[model samples]
Target: MPIQPGETIPSMKLTQGTPDGPRETSIDELFGGKTVVLFGVPGAFTPTCSARHLPGFVEHADALKAKGADVVACMAVNDAFVLDAWAKSQGVGDKIVMLADGAAELTKALGLELDLTARGLGVRCQRFALVAKDRKVAHIGVEAPGAFEVSRAEAVLGAL
Candidate 1:
């Protein structure tokens, strides 16, 4: 089932890379005692993702922070290198936390995995954003296929 508002996130270890090396970050570790804005994209560097989705957040990082987001993070079903590079290219390395769900573990756990074999894109994440406080989801915005309405920074800000 898709995760819903007021539900505690399950304890799942997701891989992310820092300046040092790749490591595991648990759901609790990420959401515990924090107000977080978590957004997922289909893939790194894809047209819609790069042109619209991720950029919206990157452009509004300060606004989001001002609205009580302790951390704004972007996740994709790609490797750490791709995510890191994407963040740097967007000039959002300092603003957004880039997380890699290389094996689609986190995507599947959230029931947001998309099978894009027809597009030759393999497994990807559905576009969505969640406002989380203290490890529980406060609001969830899931976009319809090929739609960029709900998960945009503007939408998330309204939710906040």
Candidate 2:
């Protein structure tokens, strides 16, 4: 099963693309002592991910912060370079952090891995979002297969 409300975010190191370069960060470092809104995408540049999911978060980053979110992050199974480029393409700047779970380690740790090997995409993270307060889940929304309602930024903001 996936992570649920009240569960602690798994302790795992993941890469994130920064203007300086790729940096290794752990879940605790990202979520500890903060209210974090983290969203996972199947891939960095896929249709729904690029067109709606990430953009939605970017559009609402300020509102989310205003609502008490200390950090807004977007994670994908892609590498740091790809994620960095995607962040640039999306004009994300410093508004959102781009996390790279290249090997899906954190995804599996969260029990939110979606295997797409048959489709040739290998293993990927599911479309999901979670609100974590001080390293524990306050809310989590995992979308149904091919669906995009529950994990939208608007939905998460309402939860906050």
Candidate 3:
């Protein structure tokens, strides 16, 4: 089932790269004790993702923080290195957490995986965003295919 507003984030491992190497980050670890704004993209560096989705959050990170968001994170189906490079290219800096859902573990757990096999993109995630507080989803928005409405940063800000 798709995750809903009252549900806790799924217990699965996502990844992030540290100077040491890539490592696991549990869903609880990311949303366990804070108000987190988590957004997922189909892939890192894709046109829509790079040009609009991710940048929206980066530009509004401070605004979200001002509205009581403790963390603003962006996740994609790519590995940590690609996510990091995408962040750097967008000048993301420390404004957003670049999460790597390399295995599509978290996306599948949320029932949001999109299989783009015909396009050779393999399994990926749909564009979506949510607010989680102390591990439970408080609000969420999943975009329609090829649409960029409810999942954007402004949508989350209005909810906050």
How close is every model to the real structure, measured as TM-score?
0.94, 0.98, 0.95
Assess candidate 3 and give its TM-score to the true structure: 0.95
User: Where's the lowest-lDDT run of ten residues in candidate 2?
Assistant: 19-28
Candidate 1 pairs with clashing backbones: none
**Where does candidate 1 stray beyond 4 Å?**
none
How far is each candidate from the true structure, as Cα RMSD in Å? 1.3, 0.6, 1.3
Question: Over the full model, what C-alpha lDDT does candidate 3 score relative to the true structure?
Answer: 0.89
For TM-score, candidate 2 versus 3, the one ahead is 2
Give the true-structure RMSD of model 3.
1.3
lDDT, model 3, position 17: 50
Deviation in angstroms for 143 in model 3?
0.5
Displacement of residue 139 (Cα, Å) in model 1 is 0.5
Best by lDDT: 2
Worst 10 residues of 3 by lDDT: 17-26
Which parts of model 2 have CA positions greater than 4 angstroms off? none
**Candidate 2 accuracy as lDDT:** 0.95
Per-residue lDDT value at 49 in model 3: 96
